[model samples]
Target: MRLLFHVQHFLGVGHHRRAEALTRALVAAGHTVTVASGGAPVPGEDWGGARVVHLPPARVEAADFRTLRHLDGTPVDDTWREDRKQKLLALFGDVAPDILLLEGFPFARRQLQFELLPLLEAAKAQPRPPLVATSLRDIIVFNKPPKRHEEVLDLVNRFIDLVLIHGDPALVPLERSFATADRIPAAKKAYTGFVAPVPPSTPNRIASVVVSVGGGAVGKALLWTALHSRPFTRFADQPWLLVGGAMMSEAAIAALRDAAPEGMSVERFRPDFRAVLAGADLSISMAGYNTALDILQTGVRSVLIPFAEGGETEQALRAQLFAEAGRAVTVDQAGLTPDLLGASVNRAADLPPVTLDLALDGARRTVEILTAREAAR
Candidate 1:
């Protein structure tokens, strides 16, 4: 089966990374996959045997996530939207895929409706319309208004054939964030568990503390706090590896590095971040979906300071859930300080590794689900 997957990540690379994992899994399962990415490319992403289509990229200008701009910082105007829509339609016509998978839409990434609506229209107009599914992570941002939920429900019911909730329902259900999830037919809804990398063997475990920010776009506060808090912790003399995500500016990275006291080191990104986490004494970072998955798979003691800007509650909720389960410690963004962060680090470091019962075979399960759906069709 030929599959066309669309993903757009504005703030961080987590969304694209998960999509890439699913793409690779689908390809491994003997399906030809084409990924259409609308966000700016990360430095060293591996799509793995799947065809890639780079749409005119755009990124969030601020924590508000309201304004989107090109890599050059120019605002995305109507002309750019039109071009992207045309390109997407052209790609859809060319691929004529057996399955059309949208990473997040109606549920999230409503900003791309300009192109996605048109793409959906084109897909439906096909004589034998391909199965259209929305791929989503466990928790969604819960700040959307009631009207927004209604809009999403209407769109899903009208166009989407399936909603693959890529998370363990036992851990966190779709309705927690999406209030109207029950409105979607049960036949169209399926859980594929949480998509995460299989834990690699820890052959060369680095003993330093690991701190990371997903994509490095909005992690300056957390990174800076962690750097300063390192000196205040019991492991003051131990090495602290601070990863400033790929999107972090070099100037910001240099500033953080200069601010670091004796035992701390800083870098832009780490390709083997999960391995680094697996070997570390403790993990410290924002509680994004991918980062949380890495922490869970490694079962590393962790201190999570979820990014709460722009009224985003997804990460905060995830951190709270993990904390309640004793998997990690949480430091609310509002009360984050060097002393508090240091205390949390010490507390998390002293805890034993947590063994979670949630499913980690989501990528493979996703492929199986899509393949079965295709076969039935």
Candidate 2:
């Protein structure tokens, strides 16, 4: 089946990463796929042999997401929005896909309604409208206003044909984060395990400590504290590789490299990050969805510090759950201290390697679901 996958990453690239994983899975299964990316182009991302369509990229200037800017530093005006919407409609006409998969729509990305709502409408208007679906993560932001919740329900029930949740219910159920998810029709929701790249079967050649933060734009505090907290931890003597985020400033990343504190090395990003994590003695990182899966796949001893600033609770909840499962140790970002982190590291390293019984084939399963539905058609 031909598939049109629309993805946008305003800040952190986790959304884009997960979307790409699923796209690749679809392509590997012999489906024709096209990825329509609406965010700034990542330097060296691969789409698993699928065709890509780059839309006018708009980036969030800050965490508030109130300021949108083009990559050339121009503010996004109404004219840009209109043009982008027209292009999206044109693409819909061109692809005429059997499956229309939107990443993070009603559950989030409310900011892109100008374009997304029209895209949804176009698909539904087709004489042979595609099977519309949404690709959602395990947890969404918690505690939204009552009216906002109703609005989401209305949109899903109105436009969406399927909701593919990329998580194992054994780890996190949809209702756990957004209680309103329970209201969606049972047949419309499919928990497809966690959408993550399959880990390498090869063993690691080097043993070191891996420290990373997703999207580097908002993880300065975590990386800053980590640079200094190593000495207090049990693996102070082990080599450390600190991965600087792609969005982090050059000067900031350079400063980290300079302040390596003896056995630590700092780099912008690691294409081989998963393989490195597989053989690491310990991992110190934030609790994002992809990273959580990495820790799960590698069974790496880990200390997870969930990003919890500016009313962000997604990571906090994920970290809490991961820690409760004895998969990792949690350190509160609000009250983080070098001494406290060191102690947590010691405790985490002593914990047993992870051995999960839950399904981890979310990407493949997602493709299978779409294939089966298209076949039924």
Best by TM-score: 1
User: Residue 142 CA error for candidate 1 (Å)?
Assistant: 3.3
lDDT per residue as tens, model 2, 55-108? 999887545665668887678899999999999989989999999999978888
In Å, residue 182's CA in model 1 sits off its true spot by: 1.7
Query: lDDT of each structure?
Result: 0.87, 0.86
When summed lDDT is taken over every stretch of 10 residues in candidate 1, the lowest stretch is 199-208
Question: RMSD for each model, in Å, please?
Answer: 1.4, 1.7
Highest-lDDT candidate: 1
Assess every candidate by TM-score.
Answer: 0.96, 0.95
Clashes of each: 0, 1
After superposition, candidate 1 runs with Cα above 4 Å error: none
